[model samples]
Target: MKSNSHFSNSPFGKQKANKDKANSLKNLLPPLPLFILQPLLNHIVSSVAKKHPELFNRLGDSANKVFLIDPSDLPLFLILQPNPLNPTLKAYNQNEIIEHDTYICGTFATLMQMIDAQSDSDALFFNREIRVSGDSEAMVALRNALDDMEGSLAKDVAKSFGVLSKPVLLAMQKFSKNSGKENG
Candidate 1:
């Protein structure tokens, strides 16, 4: 039998790659205190929500649901309440437990794929690349809302920081393209 370890397409190999990628990313991302990160998260979320009010239109009743967005490779978790009138997104340490109506777990790249609308969420879910738990209704509604939205949230997020972010975004884009990794 062929060794699964050598084939990047295999689960074992993919897990190892993800682990290496996570280590590389964690080193680059500063270990900022949650207090500092909280305000940043709040501002970004507020900016995104305000800039794209239509994102919550398909949410309907599910707009009230609390969502825990966990990037498995990261040390922080984001709890989001997609209320159009009063949206809130807060960050918490990975060790902290919080109440949420729905939970979506995936790697940073996987979540980026969703944000960029580069992948079909259902395919990702079926492929076991992304995991969803808790209220299925809310998950579906949220996915629908994301699907209905135009433009990438990533660009909007970068724009939220004003002119200063544009160069950084461009540089990151250049690096990602040259990173050799498929999802970079």
Candidate 2:
């Protein structure tokens, strides 16, 4: 079986090939430069801070912690430092090494749904759809903070960017709903 694993018809072979193709495609696409993307990220955190001050407050001591949000399907990674006085979200290349208190890995849709309280974080983690490491207590605090809040954080995130907010938010909702992780 191992010797014939390269056969395209084999399930293992097909999965491997698809994984390789994904990785190859990822390498071909460079993430947007941080300098170019940082302003938008800044606006997101700032707007969220202003509109939902309780979010950081809910984070308690974890508010000072740094988080690396890694979306498996995207070519970029997001570094979130939700410090109350100086909160920030920044983009980085997938390979960029950065210091962070915690790492949250999942698909973009899953992360968004989790933030919006549309999906069960435990189910997502148990099912291996989302992987979290480091600062367990802080991660819990962050989750609790998001859960404690009302309203759609995702919608607020869209609202941070002017003009296309509504459509973008609708698209996000549709995307997450169709993402098929709602049960989780």
Candidate 3:
């Protein structure tokens, strides 16, 4: 007669193994954190602003208050104060007292990624990725400003971010080929 290993027939061991497999699967998912992304976005926005001071100037004039609300924090808006005097963008939550010039609301993840990727920010509005609930005229003004900025910066930023990459298509093709081999 031989002694059984500790985990060989233990219910707890089976549960632990299942848990470990689930954790491994979770680890395989994309790991982009919003906190890590914010600063990168702030940098990109600031850089774009610096490159084209005219746009911010126009935005400052057109927009009385600007809010950057994260969709995850629904019903609570994160107001972005664009200082005309100092010309800097500051963020504030609903609880935090601050002045806003205009509200540009979206999911922080989507907004930051769009900005960083230099894709059409207006796409968010049209595609309903970002929703604007107030001040249609102001939104239109902001859209025009973004259009101008996009004309100047989108190409360069898209190239730098590799937004035009066909990696997803390539990956799908590769996956289909592998699956065909398995079936054959």
Candidate achieving the largest lDDT: 2
Give the alpha-carbon lDDT of every model. Answer: 0.70, 0.72, 0.46
By summed lDDT, the worst window of 10 consecutive residues in model 2 runs over 1-10
Candidate with the greatest TM-score versus the true structure: 2
Tens digit per residue, CA lDDT, model 1, 1-184? 1121223243323243334435655445655488986876787788878877888878999888888787666667788888898898887765454556676877667777776788889999999888776677888999888877788776777777787679756854654444325433
State candidate 3's TM-score.
Answer: 0.43
- Greater lDDT among 1 and 3 belongs to 1
lDDT tens string, model 2, 1-184? 0122123343323233235335755657765576887887787788888887888777988888777787666667787888899888888776555556666777778898798888999999999998776667778998998797778887788877679998878987887665446333
What alpha-carbon RMSD in Å does predicted model 1 have with respect to the real structure? Answer: 9.4
Residue pairs in steric clash, candidate 1?
none
For model 1, the stretches where C-alpha displacement exceeds 4 angstroms are 1-32, 170-184
lDDT of 3 by residue, 1-184 (tens): 1112432344323233234324543335443344554564465456666666666656755444454443332223343444444433433223333333333545444554454445577676788766554344555666666666544343343333455425533543454445334323
